[model samples]
Target: MNYRTILITALSCALVACQQTPTKPHAPNNLVTQAPALGAPVAVYTTAKNTEQRLSQGTTLTFAKSVQPSEGEISVFVNPHKSFQTFIGVGGAFTDASAEVFAKLPQDKQQELLTAYYDKEQGIGYSLARTTIHSSDFGSHSFTYIEEGDKELKTFSIDHDREFRLPLIKQAIDAAGGELLVYASPWSPPAFMKSNNNMLKGGKLLPEYFESWAMYYTKFIKAYEAEGIPIWGITIQNEPMAVQRWESNIYTAEEERDFLKNYLGPIMEREGLGDKNIVVWDHNRDLISQRANTIFEDPEAAKYAWGIGFHWYETWAGGTTMHDNLYNVAQSFPDKKLLFTEGTNERFSRDKYQHWPNAERYGHSMINDFNAGTVGWTDWNILLDENGGPNHVQNFCFSPIHADTRTGELIYTPSYYYIGHFSKFIAPGAKRISTTVSRSHLLATSFQNDDGKTATVVMNQSDDDIAYNFIVEDKEVELTIPARAMQTLVY
Candidate 1:
């Protein structure tokens, strides 16, 4: 839970590329440059400053030579970032924005901004997005494909979706430069199956309706396929361990295991829906052991699920666990893919109000996650209202950008710039390379493209300048890093 505090403080950007640097520690004075603000005067380095500080583009970016590659190796492809959990995708309040906000914008302007956001990945990168099947913690209230208790499940339909979600989602997908990774998850079950009789409060699917729920997932896959959106994987539940005050369900490990093995597994297979991937434990990192045990106990459940999903809610870090505890699942369940399903530093809680330095966040997360064998990485709320959203749910965090709900306005958040610092450049097929770090506060990661190009990312969390050396391929470079900054170097 304190992760939000740590993460929020790391990326409280109000801003990518190669923000990489050297790995050794030195002094702070070396990395200092005449930095420029978002819209500030461009600096002109005099010949004297350039001679003394080795400045370029008016910035003092220095390099220090290394004696040897940090210490070990992190090969990008040979030991690729492995994860069985395929992405369910991520987007937010934006689906509703068309009616509430985008409708007010001129058609040309709407098309332009939409293209910029959803299309950037098409040029050389990739984008996999997620959305709720209906209402979610970020939506107005609890809802499903249809009103509840209509037996025989004949009325089960996503017809209402065509008017809202499908259109907006389709628009974004088409805008993406390449094929989009599309998946859907539910925040709650149809109200009928709940004990409280409302999706707003948590409920357990009364065992009798198990088959119906399985069919529900299949129907969604079939429906999306009909609309040209293929459902790649269906996460059994979103945040299984979270019993929130909004649309949610409470499913214990035993319940999920039984449901996946006995109900969902057989039903989907019988329905010839076996090609789709089944994932479990769409919860936080702390619950990895719980998920591991449940999947391990029920051999049948383990057989059906390709992998598991986790969030960054709790800080599972300790000095002795091979790296932090976040790596334990990958360390223990090496064969099962680990997908980080849903995460956001600013979940709109009063606790989210603060400044998290940008360098430590996106850079650090991408480092740890890929290192932990996470193949699919996504954030919550692709877009939100300027004030975070027209969210009745209040706890809605956001993506890199937010389109105003009342007016056609766009506001880019730090998270957007942060994600772009990575996603906009690293394509899906790209591999993370091996790396080693010797300094405590100096964090690092590396990647290798299929064509043999090299990319290394490093972040210096200390408040002072540091000197370091980095060796890529066979060339060694010396670097001097400044305090309060992060860097990425690619060759």
Candidate 2:
């Protein structure tokens, strides 16, 4: 079916579901239904078994008196009053590769992409964004803002980004209703500032260049702001513990802590850029807790850190994702925030554009991460070419949306819809409410918006379609989730 037909059918289903009146009880054995004073109608949207059903609106469920769930029956319970972390937002990195690819697309396609990601009415509302400090593996080449030996940074300029990156970022901010919380991260400092004098293959930041390196962040923030792109924060380093063929830098937890407290933090304050958030440990979950302890346990360093940032790459070794570590850090330092800074399905191939597992990966991680007290989440690259790159190090990876640069065609992956299942309904400033599920096959999270609308996202990964009771306080609604599908119920 065409997009218009699908949208209309979905909306029709929602309208019918919302307007239907309840008849006398034909209550099932598991639920003894009684009339409850209903509040707002619950509108359900699903991206389910059918590819056409992406973010499609389904029936609006009616509230009935809460019933005790039977022994084997599945149920999803949401408590709107009991809330946790205030959501910052959800989005992807606007990397050089994304920007360069975006520049190659047709004008109309470019507009379509911008609207698809940033326009709340026409697209998934992405209020948060990330960009690199210099060059990353995702970029075409290694780069720095200043001349190689310019420690004084007087020769610093963002002219390199003027051609593609900066313009795309500015347009994205405008598309996001003139407000987007953007954070910057560096994969490595300039080669001259590193011990190995190379931007690739993990090297340490030379101790002598500590002061100049700190000043680099301030200069980047100012330069971007000068172009009318306000940076919300900066992570000390990206994947600080990893050694890769691409740009990388290593920082022992203590070294990172000392650098922050002694150099970066004080320098920012001295330069009057202290208000910008400073995020540390932009690495994986395996070392997150240790990194948090090393930095947070030190009062001076802790004062500089706005939060801890982590990635999901540690799971690449073929083990369970260490989601528990996030909770451990959150509980250990309640004052410090947690952010899922980067995650994306690697090993890209044109054939896997419609890959469902990729989408499920996002759904699974996002639900658990938010439940673990993460305030925000960011995906890796916002857009990539059909070949999955323009990647300099030949490390091509998947993006939720890929443009076939040759054909000027856009391929929307299931991951895009999966991400939309949360980002679209859960607004910024929303508070995550308490949500729990009775079945192991299902995963869920809920957030209550400032407007009193609650978005409860449910994911069914099991093979069989499951019917469950969606319970909210004293009321409940019967619902069925398709196998390997995700739904967002908004009320």
Q: Model 2: clashing residue pairs? A: none
lDDT of 1 by residue, 1-491 (tens): 23212222332111112222221111111222122122222121110110222111234333232244434521111112311221222222234533334444567746655654554432212366666666776644455776568645788787767765677677766776435676667777877777666676577777778888888888888888898887777788887777777778888988889899999989989988998888788787776777877785577888888777777766545422222545666556655666667766564532333333422455466667766656667676655555665465676654455565556666544444334444544545444555556676666655544343334555556777666665433334456555534455544
Give candidates' CA RMSD values in order: 10.1, 6.8
Q: How many angstroms is residue 90 displaced in model 1 relative to the true structure, after the best TM-score fit?
A: 9.6
Per-residue accuracy of model 2 over 1-491 as CA lDDT, tens digit each:
44423433444221000111111111111222222246647889888765578889876678878889996899999876566777888999999999999999999989888978887766777888999998999978889999999999999999999999999999999988888889999999999999889999999999889999999999999999999999999999999889999999999999999999999999999999989999999889999999999999999999999999999888888898899999899878888889999999999998988888999999999999998888889999999998899899899999999999989988888898899887878877767777899988999999766666778899999978999999988888898988899999887
TM-score of each predicted structure versus truth: 0.76, 0.93
Best by TM-score: 2
Poorest 10 consecutive residues by lDDT, candidate 2: 14-23
Clashes of each: 39, 0
Give each model's whole-structure lDDT.
0.56, 0.86
Q: What is the lDDT for 478 in model 2?
A: 90
